[model samples]
Target: MKGRAIAGIALILLGAYLFFMRDENISTGSVFAYFWPTLFVIPVGILLHWLYFGVFGRSAVGVLVPAGIVTTTGIVCQIATLTDGWSYLWPGFILAVAVGLFELYWFSGRNKALLIPINILAGASLIFFVAFSISNLLGKLALGQPFLAIVFILAGAFLLAARKSTP
Candidate 1:
């Protein structure tokens, strides 16, 4: 891409970001301010790439990386903004990685090797998020026998999901 085109695109995106931020009343000085604009740029980038490649007759699975990362970052930022800290939102990154891997596996001709790690990341993210939520809500209750049983059940469910997703 030419420098002028890139600059124009950047300016347009910046304008849109500023407009939305103002419209939504989201603080520009918030802790997540730095990452918020990415939610806009990343999706636009993905769509532009797809239009240039996919609609033009070619497409690649690599597009999913940015798509997943941006999505995960947006989710994490929103959650963190609400929670007032990073806290339990870190699992979002794992889920994003799993999303990327799953997209690759699905779009890149079902490469079997990607399935294992995708499942692992997805399962671990789910399990971690659940544990974090339970622990925060139940505290001592979360550490008792019932908690373990719930974890076991969730783990089994994760395994089953993995099995189902696999070819």
Candidate 2:
């Protein structure tokens, strides 16, 4: 029964692919671009989860490492694709590895040793993401004397004026 189901699914997928490709106006690239997350990443993540939970049980928590990786990659790519933010968002790839390591640390008996690399990788990924994204967000905040002067003046004025007034 399982083999039959698998064969049926494959047949359906192949038929769908051929049916879609039959259209001359539709380029395969456009048709398949969004298919990767569904066809590969999602299935791979689910399979990893199934292995850990359904098949091997808690003893195989290590499978979550790859599951985390694939899931993160899919999320990052989906966000990038939707928002057209491929530029600074590339730091997510580094963050993805960190996430996988963190999952391994969390699930695999909470090994204290893994904390070091997990913290380092996650910290570095965040730092890079912040640094890279700031350039796009504030344009370096127009780092000039005028900007600093305004900020300082505002802070000083606000502090002095907002202080409690004696009756």
Candidate 3:
């Protein structure tokens, strides 16, 4: 537990430093300049946890490390987005849903009830995201724009509910 706490604190400090550092103004665009390599820590943390679990069979620390890393990454991203004027919400939300679905598929037991709700929520969120993107792109369509979003949301909900009710 102490090790996990230390790792968590380290991740937070590293993220804070990365986000708060002074930006160097330059015209030449470099790949490293556009992307922060430190973000890879999240996946590296997940991999470390997986390896530990595989070797030791099972341990609470194994879970804590990965969860801590992901949570820290999310916090950093959220803070950076809000403070730095970066649009992180959409991508963050999508990544979170994808991760949740992957976890459900990989780790969950065969329980139809739990799976159905998760699928429905995932489907709805995906459809809403798509609708939002489309609406933004079709700004000139100027005819019942909000209605289109509502239609998409309703369609997604109906399809998910129907699938759930079906065999």
Q: Which candidate is the best by lDDT?
A: 2
Model 3 whole-model lDDT (C-alpha atoms): 0.53
Task: Kindly report which residue stretches of model 3 are placed more than 4 angstroms away from their true locations once superposed.
Answer: 1-41, 48-53, 56-95, 140-167
Summarize candidate 1's per-residue lDDT along 58-157 as a digit string, tens digits: 3555766666656666666655654454656678878978876776676667889998998999899999988876666665454666777898999999
Name the lDDT value of residue 79 in candidate 3: 50
Q: What is the C-alpha lDDT of each candidate?
A: 0.66, 0.76, 0.53
Query: In model 1, which range of ten residues has the least summed lDDT?
Result: 30-39
Residue pairs in clash, model 1: none
Maximum-TM-score candidate:
2
Where model 1 places Cα greater than 4 Å from the true spot, the runs are 1-59, 139-167
Q: Taking the tens digit of each residue's C-alpha lDDT, what string does model 2 give over 1-167?
A: 98998899667755655565565455667546634665667678778878887999888877888888888887787556544677778888888888888888877778998889888878888998997786655544775556657889999999989969799
Clashing pairs in 3: none
TM-score of decoy 3: 0.40
Could you tell me how far off, in angstroms, the CA of residue 68 lies in candidate 1 after the best superposition?
A: 1.8
TM-score of each: 0.54, 0.63, 0.40
True lDDT of residue 106, candidate 3: 44
Off by over 4 Å in 2: 1-31, 139-167
lDDT of 3 by residue, 21-116 (tens): 547443334323333433454555456556545664344333533444464456445454435523323544544544444444445454466566
